[model samples]
Target chain A: MTYFHSVKLHEDKCKGCTNCIKRCPTEAIRVRGGRAVIDDARCVDCGECIRVCPNRAKSVVTDSRALLKDRKFNACLVAPSFFGQFRSEVSLGRILASIKSLGFSHVLEVSRAADVVASALSKHLLGPNVRYPALSTSCPAVVRLVQVRFPDLIDHFVPFDAPMEIAAYAARQEIKLATGCSDDEIGVFFTTPCPAKVTAVHQPVGQGHSQLTGALSMAEVYADAFKFLPKVTHEEPVYGSARGLAWAVSGGEGTAIAKDDYLAVDGLQHVIALLEEVELGRLRSVKYIEGQACIGGCVGGVLAVGNPFIARLRIARMSQRLVSASLPALDLAPSALTLRQTLLPRPFLQLDANIEVALQKLNELEALVGQLPMLDCGACGAPHCRALAEDIVRGTASSTDCVFVLRKQVSSLAGELMDLAGKLPPAMGRG
Target chain B: MVEQAVLEVAYQVVGGDFSQAGDGASRLKRVLQQIGLAPALSRRIAVAAYEAELNIVIHAYSGVLKAKVSPVKVEVWAEDQGPGIPDVELAMKEGYSTAPDHVRALGFGAGMGLPNMRRNADELEIKTVLGEGTIVYMCFANRA
Candidate 1:
């Protein structure tokens, strides 16, 4: 069985829409016995199911409190979008304090890492032979999609680590230096609003494993932050430009890639369609493309609280209120930028990157897909289209993998009940 | 005469359109899936068959991707009327590709096509004559 570090589907909460079953890239989930079941084998743990489920059934298996209970030095790198979830009166510092009260020794704003990524991206984007424009590597889901679906555009992906990865690396480095602890002794957790980050921890891009100890969801942190807001003291705000702050939006990466060139696409289906155009060479001259699998970028993540619109407003307001005009200049800090770039894992899309097992699985999948009905009805608790195609190919599922087949069986049974009930009562019939 | 195949797709390649060469192969892959071929084998066959078809589309003046499905494997034939490979041995190398700059931009012309086709298909056969057209026959074993 393939090991899935994330992509947990709660059975009791699932309404059996099978939406997740269809949306999963690896055909990881199957609907069986009136519930969606996650197959460990086929699942790459991409978390597409968590994003599409309206009933809030699909969830990630995050790091437990046990992992943090007795930890010596634990640091939390909070996402900026968390600021927009609650009322505006509660400042972000209070939220950080709330998390700090819950056993965290220190809390660092991830926005600082965003500052570093900006400088790195600018330098890389200005490189030679980068004619096709650079694509942002921020969204792990979008990056994975490119690896599997659009390998042709692999070079177009900006050769840089995302803000989250950079922040995790920086946070770890800082904690060790400040606390005088070994690298392994310092635990670093990312306050994420999505499950993709959780998957990224295990199967990181450019690197086989992540430096992050774990991920804490934004929704999971909201209650504690709200209750602790009154007790904590607020810290001075960190500074970043409006454009950098705008990374919370759908096309924010594109804006950063090039003001006059490039395009940004949001939402999973929309991004998939645009990728087809890119693969077909229709957008050849375009310099950069920012593809976010989520609707409003990170703010609209499934694990986030409230609507993305509110989050956008909060981000905008926060950006405008920044006290500093320019970023603090780097004072020849030993070229941390170069070291940071090397720290990132190379793109895992290389043909040398484990095509042997993938090839074997592909053979098995091809055989199974042939036997399926090709309906892609999304009845199997999976979304329709090719995902179901991949599901059946893997031995974890079968042809009845579609839930519609079972629904039809149940409906026919219901029809029999209605017909039988239409007859008169026994006494009346006898009379 | 019984027109043997219910579906037949053909394309004409203008010299340097190597990047767009995979379009036809991808369409063929979808069609194979639509006709209810198992996905695992379809994926394997799709890769090899796509590589073969891409070779013809990119290098040849014109080519055809023809397929027919039965209870078992789907039989595919890619016939190209372009300048044929002079040496079948050297052409089969894993890194051998004749694609040009414009093609490279589109991610093709990587000399991995012939080898990839052999890897994906259950059975593959290629017949070529220098200065004449070439024909490739491939089969993706139907596990359905």
Candidate 2:
């Protein structure tokens, strides 16, 4: 029952203007005591709050450079989105070399793992028991969202380790055999674009534990990579296929798998809509769904630098340059890429622990909703009237907390006072 | 331990409004989920409700989809004023749709509606008046 969240609210910086609460896909946030509070059970760590918070109060929890310096042997597992942040002209080799200069012993590209995932996914799709419109499990936020909001569709999720997890395993194995270090001695760090990856590493959904030691934000590593790009002399061996590198942007997985009826949706809201269609059984014709939490895939991550469109363009140019090249032999064992454990649904919004109690609450909620004006105005510090009713049932709020309801009560009391004055007070004053 | 309480909610379905066809079922699904029903049970109810909703939209003039929830079972009653099916047995058969070609072009009326609903619901009862309308009742057991 341990909870690990990558996004944290900085108390001093939070203005509690209800921006994050309104934008949060899961309604996991509440503005209480003039500051935003995140419900750990409901947060999926999509970093949407980090993106929408005007005061920059929302920030990611990541491993610092000091932690990297302490490791005996450090290996950086680079997300393909990392390449999109740099100039299009920069070679992948130069980017790899630049990452090495940031105090790392080895640099591994997650795209290579993505290639393995693409292969595994194709094989899974060809199986007789494959679920129709199987959802991609690569995006941790998407997986968590499904667990919370679309529990019945959990079986539709393709059971496989994400490219980051696979890359961390491969990177650790390579670094271990080369340096003859113990597992604890080699720190495998992932350069992540979103906070969900950080949460994934710390509290993995389908695995016993993450192979990665920690995650470093792409934004945090960008400046160092840029400063050292020209200084590196040694050329790092290329490991990623063109199709694999394409995983950094939206539609890349569907395209790489060569599925004609696959759907690729980006942005948290769009993904939610697509999942809703899937829930309604309207997407029966689709073979697979690739959902990314960010608008333009990993390139549009909250922690990523530059505009998403520009980053996507750069990634596309990079893909075009490498598409014609032959793929290298994979260095890791293919069997290691499969997920070791099953992911269970996380029903974050369950009405109550007891079903009978929940039904009673539902009745109470219905009664309360009937009494309130259905104006979804966020005047009560809750997102909507329905939400306020739920809060009232939970004993976290009262009906009078609503400004409209309070105004009605005040006006009615004033009318009663006026009527009494007309009847008795006027006679006493005249006499 | 006390007598189970049944909570009922009614939705008005407009005919030929493709955009709003699934709204009733979707809302019902959310309610079931929030009521702490098992996912499998909730899904079955949702699928049955959706198919029934779609049937009214495609063939009926207008309809009312009502969902009743209790501790023992979840029930959906869909009644519509439309040209009733001459043969309920034929209507229940897969790929036996009588929808116009235009409806077929919209990717619906492959005639899987009633069959799919039957497949998901534990109990189904249909009542229709030849020239007037049809009423379909679906029930799902709320087993722990």
Candidate 3:
């Protein structure tokens, strides 16, 4: 099955302008057969395609109110980025109440799980075999990109679950402990600013399955969150401070896992560049590298209702009085209570760390790469020639993925391939 | 007549021109995509093509990348008209290189080029005429 959650093309709306195709880091979209087609396996769901599509052909998957249909007890784990998207006048307490008003039985701040992730990462970072840098896996798109493009650098990624995953785990654990709700009876939903987080919930990383029932886009939940604020007051102070809250921004992970020797990078391209730096041993001294697939952190998400700059300013202003010092202390339910420090999936390294397949795929791809014209025009929707090569190897796509490459190849081979030129040699010949 | 056209794309290795270094690879990627290969094949070709392009622009002196795309497959050949490889086998090793200090300053020259090309392509052939030009041939098959 193709691995993707959000960032699908609205076939009818796509004008085949190549705007969305050019922006995709993985070149997952292409103007094929006169319209855009998303190569599911190649797409990291970073939402770059959504941001640049003028025709609004690109879209994210969403949970219908129908998701709430069968569940008995439901809770909303609000992401901190929400504070930045709405009016500061609406107290965060009111936002929680607003979420509660949306029929959620309870509202818990995801920042609480951020605390758990931070604590786990800190301990993991301070441990031995600190041989490689730790890459934050908070963003699923970023993690998937690592799996697809920077497989060798996977070792650098801390195997610990992301803040959202940990949040889902902890939130569910708390719910079950307090109310004795069966796993199926209680549903946990995440308020997401970006599509990758949603995909992560559906197709989990680090562990086999995510505890999250589904995700509610921050944009979608905004109106509901705002409407309920007038009735309730945010009584208990949230966990995490401006710094922790800042975690919603680019490089926030550096602060959360502040080890002095860390490199924080955001934006899909920028993060990929940093990973290349690590793979090249250029950043060998670096202990941790925090990579967010989106620019300006989650606020830069394509699905966000407003601009990141405005969202960041609002988030900062709202948390300004709280002070960074007030951020909650690192909390880990004693190691004894936590299972024997087993990172989910037993052998996390096998997920994408081993370059064996990537290497073999690379070799198979190499044979086909030399034929491609060196014009990373991104028209093929696999980003660059190299990405297109890897996508072909992964089986989700074919070399004809690039329109320019196919044209050039067919044109160049016209003389020798005259036998099949009866119909322009079929772009990719046969397949 | 079977045409034997050698297309050459030259690039300058600006010690730290990180932004433009990938330009060659990007162009090559577009070319491959236009040829109508699969995404996986295109990505592999692109990765190998870029790595080679970066090697020329990153470690070698101003160099030329040439390719011959045919019906059966494509072949990219990179030749560096700079100091030749001192040890082909060693250079092909995972982490070995003789790049200058300035080149190393930029974060590349990890000595993964030859090996990476070998890993990314179907058949990789490298011939270095010491103190002269080094010729590397990478062939990519077109399943079509």
- DockQ for model 2? 0.68
Across A1-431, the per-residue lDDT of candidate 1 in tens digits comes to 23445777777899877677667654456677788887553454456677779998977877764567656888887776676676655555556667777778777776666666666666676778774656778888777666555544566776666777777777777787788888778778887777777777766744445778888877877777767767777553344455566777676655445566668888767887776555433455677778887788888887788798888887778776655643352222424433232222122222122333333344455555555556777665555535555555434356565555556678999999999998897678655
Off by over 4 Å in 1: A12-16, A25-27, A39-48, A51-56, A87-95, A129-133, A240-243, A325-431, B1-26, B29-144
> Which parts of model 2 have CA positions greater than 4 angstroms off?
A323-327, A420-430, B1-3
The candidates' DockQ values read 0.06, 0.68, 0.06
Instruction: Compose the digit string of candidate 2's lDDT tens values, residues A21-73.
Output: 88899988888888898888889999999998999999998878777766799
Candidate 3, residue A225: how far the Cα is off, in Å: 1.6
Better of 2 and 3 by DockQ: 2
* Native-interface RMSD of candidate 1: 12.3
Determine which window of 10 residues in candidate 1 chain A has minimal summed lDDT: A343-352
Ranking by lDDT: 2, 3, 1
